[model samples]
Target: MADDYLVRIGKLIRDARQHRGWTQTQLAEALATSQSAVNRIERGNQNISLEMIARIGEALDSEIVSLGYSGPMHLRVVGGRRLSGSIDVKTSKNACVALLCASLLNKGRTVLRRVARIEEVYRLLEVLNSIGVRTRWINDGMDLEIAPPAHLDMEAIDADAARRTRSIIMFLGPLLHRLRQFKLPYAGGCDLGTRTIEPHMIALRRFGLDITATEGLYHAQVDRSIAPDRPIVLTERGDTVTENALLAAARHDGVTVIRNASSNYMVQDLCFFLEALGVRVDGIGTTTLTVHGVPAIDVDVDYSPSEDPVEAMSLLAAAVVTESELTIRRVPIEFL
Candidate 1:
């Protein structure tokens, strides 16, 4: 049993080395050991000590064996501690997910500045990666650099990742422009309780998309000849639904008007991104939007989405709740 464990660990080390395109001799030099010693370790013949195991993990940049940790995070609070100064507001999860899905519209690279690193974003990234979208966090995870492949592999979509976030439904808008037909697993998140997907369906159907939800999957079929012949009035002004409409409209060639649209923070961010892709949007921060959609967009764009208004308001609420006099910077007051 011990010999079997050694063999598995050796294979892991060897696989990591090859994945990095590192030669056995190069790994030996990094560890200050001969190639023969590295060979013995790879073959599970070397008696590796704990210190050497730690060294090997450090060189390979992975945890071969972890003690692991599990606990709920706690905040240490001292009573009556006065709070002062200001903190910059972070990005929005809504905006980040919208931006990530909208990246499919551009043929060139898309670099988003100061995106929030949240669970929603990570879930969307997993879905993107599974479908061949290459995304990386640069600038200490403050920014995201996304580069799409020549084509997305829809068959390999990550169903588990897709089901983790309701934001996955927003992908329908951009994807309708890419493929004729595809299936996405049902969206599940936050226990929001039978939130009507009808509004999204009604809005997207105007852009030639027909979606049917059955047996734990949504089958989407696109009619390429069909485009929004008239204004698309959303049934609800929900942020995610509005984003879905905006995404579908981004790749449409003619004028598309959306009424009863959301004037929330995330919708504004999506409009700004569409503009960067050369799509002209007439109304932002309003209930009505007139979008002049270009037939095709292939621009290498860089956009910095605005800060989170909800988080900013939370900071203000914190001051009132705790009776603390605090200053908050970079608040998007218009949204508030």
Candidate 2:
């Protein structure tokens, strides 16, 4: 059994090396080892230490082994330890992704301070990069700078990345204004069971957006003649739904009143971001949002979304459970 496991690990290492386009000799040079030793390691003829695996992973920039337990992790807690320290709340994942989608609305450079570096954000960034948008992590990966090209290559969008995140639906709002027609992969994320995108379609249709799902893709067409003449009511108060409506409204030339909007923390963050783009949004933190749309957004903006209230609450709960006195800083008090 141990030999089989070693062989599997060896095969993974060999595959990663080949993916990096490095020969065994090159890998040996990088690892300061002989090519024969490397060949033996790859053939499972020699045992490799965890330290060597980690070095190889770093050299190839691939996670050869996760460096943690392979099975389900079990944590045994021993009570009686008081936790008495200040914890600064990180930015919210929900807000970060919403803002990533909102970045497509701006023609000028957008700098988001202390954005959450989560998988969802990374997947969105991948999709953004596959298009013509230029995204970079600055401030030591704490901040994100997004700059959209004058013309986005919708054809070049990363379908694999798009399919990994359900947030891809948020693109409909921004893309509707940019492209008369485009196709996006079907939204996919956690296996939370078959959640419907019909609510999103219902909300966005008010902005003249029509979607047809065929062959695992959403074929979207925008009717330019259609504009929101009256208040647009959302079928559901979902965060992404409210965000999609706001994205469509941001570039409209007239005022857009969105009813039944979600005033959640993430939604509020998107509203604030839209405001920074020179789109006037009234009734933030309320169900009714009055968006004074702009014809175009072309201005550099810097905005920092508030910390995650959910994380703050989790810390608070931990302190309470441990009978500890802890200071959770930068909590979004409004959300809590």
* Candidate 2 residue lDDT tens string, 1-336: 349888998999887776454689989999999999899888888889999999999887778987556799888978888898798999989998999899888889999999988899899999999999999989898898999999999899887788768898899999998899998877762221234577788878888898886555788999989998999988878888889999999999899999999889889989988988889999999999999999788999999987888888889889988999888888887744
Span of ten consecutive residues with least summed lDDT in model 1? 187-196
Tell me the deviation in Å of residue 143 in model 2. Answer: 0.8
Candidate 1 residue-wise lDDT at 331: 83
Highest lDDT model number: 2
Across 88-162, the per-residue lDDT of candidate 1 in tens digits comes to 899777788899989988888999999888898898999999999999989887889999988899999987778
